[model samples]
Target chain A: NAGVTQTPKFRILKIGQSMTLQCAQDMNHNYMYWYRQDPGMGLKLIYYSVGAGITDKGEVPNGYNVSRSTTEDFPLRLELAAPSQTSVYFCASSLSGGDTEAFFGQGTRLTVV
Target chain B: TQLLEQSPQFLSIQEGENLTVYCNSSSVFSSLQWYRQEPGEGPVLLVTVVTGGEVKKLKRLTFQFGDARKDSSLHITAAQPGDTGLYLCAGGRNNLFFGTGTRLTVIP
Candidate 1:
């Protein structure tokens, strides 16, 4: 089913640069999320989408933006990358929000200098 | 903010040894989930405990949700090198709140 897929497994960006982290899921999930994992820390949610055209902020949503134009895609945009943004980013999806197991992507390792 | 804290941030054990990791929180959860993440990969679901005091097993791994629904424990029996990875506990309400993760390394 390909489950969840993220593009550009690894990337490095300069300060003030911008880019988009692409995520797509084939599972037909209604809930999608973007999370970043710092060293020795748990995954922190950046943004999430309940369905197409419906988005919300999560625990750590600063310095990032997200848009859900279709049911299968939710992309996170970094307008001006900063060194603090260096971390591993993961995309996940689930059939519903609560009490459901989420399927995660392989993760994208991003480094901002 | 609903936070989940994991104990024994890191563990190094020899083969065939036993180990236990904990996750605690001050707020109640409707359900809790456990996931294992290997190097260079995202976390994979291990199990989910929905009811208070519930116990579920996956082969050599045992998971128990506290009766108060605010804590959980994961125990591994006769650990093997293949068991080495980062363990994370997530509490679910309207959304899932992840714990700081317990890193386990089992040496051969």
Candidate 2:
């Protein structure tokens, strides 16, 4: 079912540039999340959506915004990219919020200069 | 912040050796899961422990959940080079919270 899919596996952005990371889940999951992983560190949440038209901030949501316009799509936007934003970004989704297993996308490697 | 602490942030061992990685927390969790991630890829779930004191085995890997649901452990017996990856432990809620990963490298 292509559990989850993320676009632009790799991206290089200059400081101050804006871009949107695309994520789509085919599993009809009610919850979707965006997380960024630094080298050797655990993942930090960026943003999450519980359902279409509902969004919430997570642990590390600075410089990022998200919108869930459809059940299958959740997109994260970087208004003004900075060097600190460089990290491996992941997208994940689960059937529900109650202890369900989450499926992840391959990941997007982002580098900001 | 509800933090999950993981020990031995990095481990390097030779093939056929045994190793254990730990994840601990003061907060109780509904469930805990272990994942393995290779370079340039997203992490994949290895096992999930729901009930307290639950023990699950996957081939040479054994996962255990603390009775209080505040900790977990993973033991790999006779490790192989293919086992090298980032081992992450996650405590489950409405959303999963991950601990600082333990990177394991099994040298051949």
Top candidate, metric lDDT: 1
> What fnat does each of the candidate structures reach?
0.62, 0.55
Per-residue CA lDDT of candidate 2, range A1-113, in tens?
A: 68899998999999999999999999899999999999888888778788999998878999999999999999999999999999999999988762677789999999999
Write the residue-wise lDDT of candidate 2 on B43-94 in tens digits.
8889889999999999999999999999999999999999999999986566
Off by over 4 Å in 1: none
Give, for candidate 2 chain A, the lowest lDDT window spanning 10 residues: A94-103
User: Candidate 2, DockQ to 2 decimals?
Assistant: 0.64
Q: Model 1: how far is A20 from its true place, Å?
A: 0.6
- Candidate 1 global Cα RMSD: 1.0
Q: What's model 2's overall lDDT?
A: 0.91
lDDT of 1 by residue, B15-99 (tens): 9999999999999998999999998889999999999999999999999999999999999999999999999998665466689
